[model samples]
Target: MTEKQVIYLDFKASKILLDGDFNAKLSDCGLAKLGPTNGNSHVTTSIIGTYGYVAPEYVATGDLYVKSDVYSFGVCCLNY
Candidate 1:
């Protein structure tokens, strides 16, 4: 499997069901990335999703990496 797939599976397995006090608290707040990605990258597609949940850079460009998983994890954390 790819690195991204491994991360996706890891996150899915780690997720908590979203019907509790912790999710309620996160519902109102958002998280930020610690830094930007390397500028020298390439992407070749357009996809659809909520802006907050989509990694801004990855959506604009196809340049994905392990950090992209970090962005998805943050959004999933909010939902849970």
Candidate 2:
């Protein structure tokens, strides 16, 4: 996925689903936001997501970015 795509604001281990064929799928997109590709971020007033999986910058400033979801994906990978 590129930065121009949507960002899964609630990305976490619990939000992922693996099928019998090991196909990964993301769920619970109620907090997702559209990411910016011009080196900018999507800012919001509400900060909601699972602890330990949310990005530090997002937690500090409610700024959403594609990297935030990438951070959560990395954490999920570490669990396996």
Candidate 3:
């Protein structure tokens, strides 16, 4: 995903799944950004995203850091 900023604000089973080779792939990139990586976090005032998928810190402090995604991914992994 070169020149793209794809943050999985909505990470669910249907959005991420195993391919033919059993390789995980992301789909339905509804909020993908067209740019390269430059920072470790994204900022947002108004809260958005799925109920449990969104990180707690993000909701509390509005800091959309990479760790937040990790927490979201962990939620997916556990649910899956």
Residues 4-58 of candidate 1: C-alpha lDDT, one tens digit per residue: 2222312321333566554522231122222223443333334444456556776
Candidate ranking under TM-score, highest first, comes to: 2, 3, 1
In model 3, the runs with Cα more than 4 Å from the true position are: 1-6, 32-42
Off by over 4 Å in 2: 1-4, 37-39
Judging by lDDT against the true structure, name the best candidate.
Answer: 2
RMSD of each: 10.0, 3.1, 3.4
Across 1-80, the per-residue lDDT of candidate 2 in tens digits comes to 55357878777777789999999888778877777756565645478888888888889998776678888888888998
* Model 3, residue pairs in steric clash: none
TM-score of each: 0.38, 0.74, 0.68
* Poorest 10 consecutive residues by lDDT, candidate 2: 36-45
lDDT of 1 at 53: 56
User: Which 10 consecutive positions of candidate 1 have the poorest summed lDDT?
Assistant: 4-13
**Each candidate structure's count of clashing pairs:** 1, 0, 0
Best by TM-score: 2
Go through the candidates in order and give each one's C-alpha lDDT.
Answer: 0.45, 0.78, 0.68
In Å, residue 24's CA in model 1 sits off its true spot by 21
RMSD of 2: 3.1
